[model samples]
Target chain A: MESVILQIAARHMRPLLVILSLVVLYRGHNEPGGGFIGGLMLGAAYILFAMGFGVQKTQKSIPVSPVILTGIGLLLALASGLIAVLMGHVFMTGEWTTLFSGTSFELKLGTPLLFDLGVYFTVAGMLMLVMFSIMEE
Target chain B: MLVLPILLPLFFMVVLIFTRRWLAFQQIFSLLATVILTFFSAMLLIDVQQNGIATMQVGSWIAPYGITLVADLLSAIMLVTVAFIGVVIMIYSPGFIDKGRQSAGYYPLAFGLLMGVNGAFITGDIFNLYVWYEVMLTSSFVLIALGGSAEQLRGSIKYVTINFVASIFFVAAIGILYGLTGTLNMADLAYKLRTIDHIPYINSALMLFFIAFSIKSALFPFFFWLPASYHTPPIPITALFAGTLTKVGIYTMFRFYSLFIVENLVFWKTFIIVIAGLTMTIGVLMAASQYDIRKILSFHIISQVGYMVMGLGIFTVGGIAGAIYFTIHNMLSKTNTFLAGGLVYQRSGSYDLKHLGGLYKASPLLALLFFIPAMSLAGIPPLPGFFGKFFLIKGGFEAGDYVITGVAILVGLFTLFSMVKIWNEAYWKKEPENIKHGRVSRRAIAATSLLALAVILLGLFAGPVSQITLEAANQVVFPEMYINAVLGR
Candidate 1:
């Protein structure tokens, strides 16, 4: 019964770690952490999942394969900057638009943060992909 | 222009990570992305040629506050070269890497390396340059150590250790520079450096910075790590490193020398010239004895890097231009040579020249492709390689640095000898009984032939090519245009 309880705890830990990694990735722009460290943290989280769940099950859980994840990360980062051109701004020029009916906090989204997220995904995918391939070998 | 290079690659790296299942889709997207980047880089180059400079600020932060991506002719030229080679390499990697589970990591690391390379090129902030250098270095670490062979691991540890030490020194140099100049913006530092007189600590700071760059560039005493470790990686990865990584370091060195260090001219001039001569002589002598094709090519990286540095030492406009031209030619020729070697290894299953023979009999097209770059590398006339060397030698002679010119010419001959040696052993000689040749892959041949065609194209189009080079050269020499562009005059 204790063993079952421990298994349940382990099952809950994966999503918890993923959430923690996201927090770290998001807070990186202002404080001590940034995209690179955040990505590495996320990579480690995936590694833990793979270790606990086994490579096959972990592979099943992650929607995209590691290689594709890297590609996606790359595209995200590029798109963040490319949006400037769409707005008739210079390439990589940050375009921020304040969207609210009145003077109230709503949602803030800009290309730089978007670029940071792209970096996070790329580094995370790349590190784990490398780690997994090497470990498999 | 500045942010696009870094952010574009960053975006693609992310996209690649999540979309790993679609291998064909990923390849198509990566190629498409590279084409887009090439168009962007070409536009930047043309813009720089016509308008003089382009700059972009991140987060709408003013100069000295937010990170700036500045593209003078020099940076734009490098971006174009990088995009051209990167596109070719991306196309070529598919042919050589074989479909495998490991490709998931390979594609991302490739983009990551590109991310670092472009980042290092366009960054206007000195601290940001260090960050980009780390990006490039760490990505290279993963790429080189990917297979984790006993030899590869050994090579990686050494590579990482050396580069890590260099990174420490790099950061330390930045710290010292910031302390002295009170600014991390390169143009600001240049402005500050000029106003200060005989500053006792400034020369020492410059020396520290020089040491950091020299170590990264593998100049003379700093070069042992390169030949020791480069051969251990798989060939395509080695090709990437040989073609791009150290050249990034050299580019950084060129950028800084023209900007802040121009204050104390005589000191750096003498120091760089001495190192250039030694680097050329030592790299060639070592290449003469190496048996492995990759190792031989690795040594030539140092030798060829010396020619570029020699141009730096001469300190004339033409001399600097020569260095710029030589750098572009060397990047293409060296990468082409390495890729060809990879194909040979793929076919014959060994890179040892002694073990390689009878390849010419089995494959004539491969031999022809190999010969084009090899002869060009030897600086034979009508090749861009020849023109690259010609401009540098002319610059050196014009500067009346006859001794340096002599060294450059001698190195050219040795480069020929080494190329001929590979030709004799790997191509012309009969394959030993143990050596077996099979039908080489069409994809491998196709990729190599494409690069071979480029070497010829660069040769035939020397006029426009050199014009681009001269424009980059002028931008490096006169950086005010860059400063003004980034920080409104």
Candidate 2:
């Protein structure tokens, strides 16, 4: 009975933290939160998940290594910078547009925001990698 | 292709993360990627030389709205130089990084570091520069503390703490610059700075930027963290950090000094001149007293940085050109020397000069290999370091700063003295029986030898390289060209 309770407790926490991390990441553009803080929280989620599920099960749940995540983050980040050049702007110039065709409006993304997202993945991935290596020890 | 060099590594770094079981495969792939990067960077250099400036916009975004990656001649030359060092270090890593010591995370972090460095060189915005600096810093923190020894942890904590403080200051500087100019673009900032009257706020911002950069470059006052942290890492890691990391700080300093902040001839210039003189003397004095090989090398890093910064302080084309050339020459020589020292440490299980005597007896080729780079680092003639010093001194004289020129020459002599100390203690001295040392691996020796050979080759081929540096200097001296090129004006 105790084991079952512990398992249930562990099971819900991982997804909860990951979702929370994404929330923090999403609200980063104009809010107090940003990539570095949000990604660190996300990495903490991975560690909690791994601790509860064991390294093997955690590895299966997130099959991608932290390295690949970091690389992709790098790609995303550089892509954000290059997007400016494509728009006929100087390098790293922030490009933005708002979307409101009729009455409804939505906040459109820009390179700085994209850069933030890239940083999010990079920090998250790097933190996970470091934690994983420490666990191996 | 501009994005390809950066993106390919980004791609591979991701793939390697999942393929943790194939660590060896990841290493090979990353090395191949770097080689291709070097080639692409070379092509880009040629293109920029012929075409003026190569600007690329990702996802087809128009100007001022999207980020741009500009490869001016200056940036391209840095890219090539960085790639050259990356390839050599990659080649050397496999032999030096033992399997027991290797982690699934090392290669990816290294690639990530390369991405940060390359991105920093290529980006045209100040905010983006800060972003890349974080990228590089975070990866470096991981690499330094990877093994997680007590010393490594301590060193990393100090390194991270200082750098984190510096990064905060850097972000503040960027914010101030943006608020002042209303734009984050480098070319745009240059134009705004020229048009705006000299204000007190601008001077304060300049000082803020200078303090932040000084910490990053480990200039005299902010240099304590370097010796404390640098000597804690494994030798190859130390070699990479010593060669590349601080130099990036210096690169940014050169860029900003050349483009944005040229007005303060009396205050900033005089201040830097005094700091450079003190940095050189203090650094060499520290090096002369160190018993450990790594510590000595670490001190020399500070002294050489002084030379490069002195060129910037002079604010002449020749001086700046010399700084550029000296930076490249120092990167190669320092990396090679540190890597060779690593090989020696691996053989002896220690880095102390007392414990590492008579290395020449068991490994004559390794001794010879270390000797060449050491001499180059000492600024021996017919080598890259020699020309770097020559150009710097010439620039100093041309600027009519004869007093600083005299100090630079004296620093050069001290540099030779420290190099000879290493030579005499490590190679020429007799082996104490207990410290005779075990045999070094052939592969390690081979890697060091290759780097040594490259140093000599760079020295011999200084003419063409000097031309490239000179052109880069010209670009830096004339901010209008950079602004016009970037803005398509």
For every model shown, what is its TM-score relative to the native structure?
0.88, 0.88
How high is the TM-score of chain A in each model?
Answer: 0.83, 0.87
Residue range B119-153, candidate 1, lDDT tens digits: 88989999999999988998899888885679988
> iRMS for all predictions?
3.8, 5.8
Model 2 DockQ, alpha carbons vs. true complex: 0.26
lDDT of 1 by residue, A1-137 (tens): 12555445557776787788788877876787767787888787777766665566677888877766666676776777679878877666776666673667765567877888878887887787777876565
**Residue-level lDDT tens digits of model 2 in B343-418:** 8787777888887678788778768888888888888989889999999999999999998889999988998998
- TM-score of the A chain in model 1: 0.83
Total clashing pairs for each candidate:
33, 24
Per-candidate fnat, comma-separated: 0.65, 0.26
